[model samples]
Target: MDDEAVIPISALQHYLYCPRQCALIHIEQLWAESQHTAEGRLLHDKADKPKMERRKGVRTVTAMPLAQPQLGITGVADVVEFHTGEDGVEHPYPVEYKRGRPKAYQADEVQLCAQALCLEHMLSCQIPEGALYYGETRRRTVVPFDTALRALTCETISATRAMTVSGRTPSATYSAKLCYNCSLFDLCQPRLLHRGESVQHWLHAQLKGE
Candidate 1:
């Protein structure tokens, strides 16, 4: 694949959350903002502003553009803190801001780890960990970029890239808990579509048996 074909790091998170959602957003360019999404956007907006600040021995840069050609993923980091070690070595720690509380899934962690991977590639340094700041709890949770997470991140990248290039939106699978809060709820109409498909399949089966 050409280096120019860069996939958004956000797609990895979206794909993990829901492949249909990812395809709808990236492939079809469909989007809607719900209260949750708006809150998340506001949180990201606050972090996305380009700025630099120093705190004690740590220097922080906000909205830093990060990309890894090998992974074909690109996105701006919310914050990259450069902490000076006792040995005078500087370590980069990426911190991502989220609107909601932590979830059972690895979507948020995968996103954070992808940022760390980008930092590793761009700076030619290894990052062992990063953090996710959740808006609901107003607390930062540290995440380790371990072997499992790294492997998952890579897999997500490849899967997301394939979905993006395929230009086909995956069919929606409805979940009341998830679809209710999704920004694209109305647009996706997961319940309606899935129900309609189910009915169609049932009718087809009846006709085939006749």
Candidate 2:
């Protein structure tokens, strides 16, 4: 992968969560850390710190560099736990730390899948699964290497590559649902762009000499 073109793994998940949010973040370069992001950052503060520790069943390495060049993605793994199997085979499971509970959306999945892909390429092993630890729930959610999610993750990577190459943020397609919690609502101006009868309002007024 091109060192300068290193893609943020979060962008893949962000696109899956909301294309508008993805565009606002990666395309328009607009962002603000709300309560959710702040909490998440605080959680990551500890994870980002350098560390190495051993537990009964596993060894933990924090701030590991993970990426999948074939998919054009890269990011830092929060933690990768080393486990030894019954057959004496060593396995690496990348664990992503999240600040909130699991969502119906695919954001977290996409991020985790990207990490799995990265680990696979890095280790030359088939990463069959990974896990997400949510701080709020204090539980680890295991994610299997299913075909559907992998496909979605690949599609997301391609879409993000296309977005960055296009170098143009898409116009806001007004939708109350998408704009509700978006950090870019004000900058995107979905309301201003789509309101008052659209372009027809201006054309009609001009033609009638109003």
Candidate 3:
């Protein structure tokens, strides 16, 4: 597949977060940055730089471009460390940087898994795991690329690709937990749209009574 036609690996995370948000950004070409997003970008500044360094038998690369043509997905990994194993082979271990603490959802994990998949295809080796570095916690959370996670990553890829191809934005459903935290909340207006839908339903019910 052409690079232009490939879906972004980050879309998997966004889709898992909210399908509407995913469509709004990827399909509708809309974006609004909140404090959270700004902070995240700032945190990524260091990792976004393209650099390579070797320290203590490990070679670390920052801002590595990753793509899996078969899966039609592409993205940049924040950091990928190559560790020399006992077999005298270098194993790629991707580490993703996030602004906040670990979420209750698997969005971050799925994103990392997608990166691992891309690296596995590009390097022709099995990636056993990766890591997520949370800025808030200043810690790394290890993520195992188990069967279930791989399955979920593939499923998310298919769903995100389908949504992107259809070019349809899902209707907004307001949830204080999700919507308010989203960077595009003002642009999405999920609460207002949900209210409109409620009013429309009420009007339809009145018309049915009449």
List the candidates' TM-scores in order: 0.90, 0.85, 0.90
> For residue 152, what is the lDDT in candidate 2?
87
**Model 1 bad stretches (over 4 Å):** 1-4, 194-210
lDDT of 3 by residue, 1-210 (tens): 865457999899999999988988898787888899999999999999999999888999999999899999999999999999889789999999998899999999999999999999999999999999999999999999999999999999999998988866788888999988898886777866653232334346669999
Q: Arrange candidates by lDDT, highest first: which order?
A: 3, 1, 2
- Tens-digit per-residue lDDT, 1-210, candidate 2: 665455789888778766656766876566877777788999999889879898877888999987778777888999998897887777999899998799888889889888988888999988889999999899999999789989988888888878766765555567787676666665556766543232334345568996
Best by lDDT: 3
Give the worst 10-residue stretch by lDDT in candidate 3: 194-203
What TM-score does candidate 1 reach? 0.90
The 10-residue segment of model 1 with minimum total lDDT is 194-203
lDDT of each: 0.87, 0.79, 0.90
Q: What ordering of candidates by TM-score runs from best to worst? A: 3, 1, 2
Greater-lDDT candidate between 1 and 3: 3
Clashes of each: 0, 0, 0
The local lDDT score (0 to 100) that residue 2 gets in candidate 3 is 62
